[model samples]
Target: MKNYILIICAVMLSQVSSAQTSQTADKKAILSVLKMQRLAWSDNNIEGFMEGYWKNDSLKFYGSNGITYGWENTLERYKQAYPTADHIGTLSFKINDITKITDDAYYVMGEYHLKRNVGNATGIFMIILKKIEGEWKIIADTSS
Candidate 1:
């Protein structure tokens, strides 16, 4: 009876430990993706910035103009609209919060600022990141 109880407790403890480890790993992955995005923007590499987004026809982005669908279309729009240094400017981000909705998804709220010679634009963004095929990618984003 003593040995059986000890085995049961060990199994339960292992399971709990695994759960916590998985959660931590997921959080780290999500944050890493966010960091990559900031770096890509700071480099003024529109293509690099697109790396954070899901490369799918269903990916969605919404801006002041309206909703845009598909990853390639969004990239094209960004490229055409912000083609020069005066427009790309210096990018900065303040991550307000990141909440895990599930093992595979997270909701992120953040502020973005672009300092340009012409003018500065600042806005808040809410993004939904989904882990697809063990990789974290932004599935949807909405910004003012």
Candidate 2:
């Protein structure tokens, strides 16, 4: 009876430990995705930057102009807005927070700064990312 109880407690502890580890890895993966985007943007590679985003029609982006839905539309929006590398400039982010919404989703709040020949721009943004097909992808973004 005592051995059975001990085994049960051990199993529960193992599960908890496994969960914590998995959560930590997932959060790290999310950060990695964002870092990749920053690098891609700074390099003036819009397509590469968009790789962090989900390539689905459901992807949403809300900006000062309005809400844009669909991944292809977002790409068009970016191309029209940025146009040239001078408009893109160098990108950097100050991540304010990354909070888990569920086992498969997280919301990230951050400030973005751009340096370019055109003009420097700064703004805050919040993005929601979800794990899809074992990859973390931004599904929604709201930027000032």
Best candidate (score: lDDT): 2
Once fitted onto the true fold, the runs of candidate 2 whose alpha carbons sit more than 4 angstroms away are: 1-8
The number of the candidate with the highest TM-score is 2
lDDT of 2 at 9: 100
Q: Per-residue lDDT of 26-67 in model 1, one digit per residue for the tens?
A: 878888887888788778888998999999999999998899
**Cα lDDT for residue 25, candidate 1:** 86
Residue 34 in candidate 2 has what lDDT? 91
Tell me how far the alpha carbon of residue 103 in candidate 2 is from the true structure, in angstroms, after superposition: 1.3
Q: Once superposed on the true structure, which residue ranges of model 1 sit more than 4 Å away at CA?
A: 1-17
All candidates: CA RMSD (Å): 2.2, 1.5
Residue range with the least summed lDDT across 10 consecutive positions in model 1? 34-43
Q: lDDT values of the candidates?
A: 0.90, 0.96
lDDT of 1 at 30: 81
Sliding window of 10 residues with minimal summed lDDT for model 2: 19-28
Clashes of 2: 0
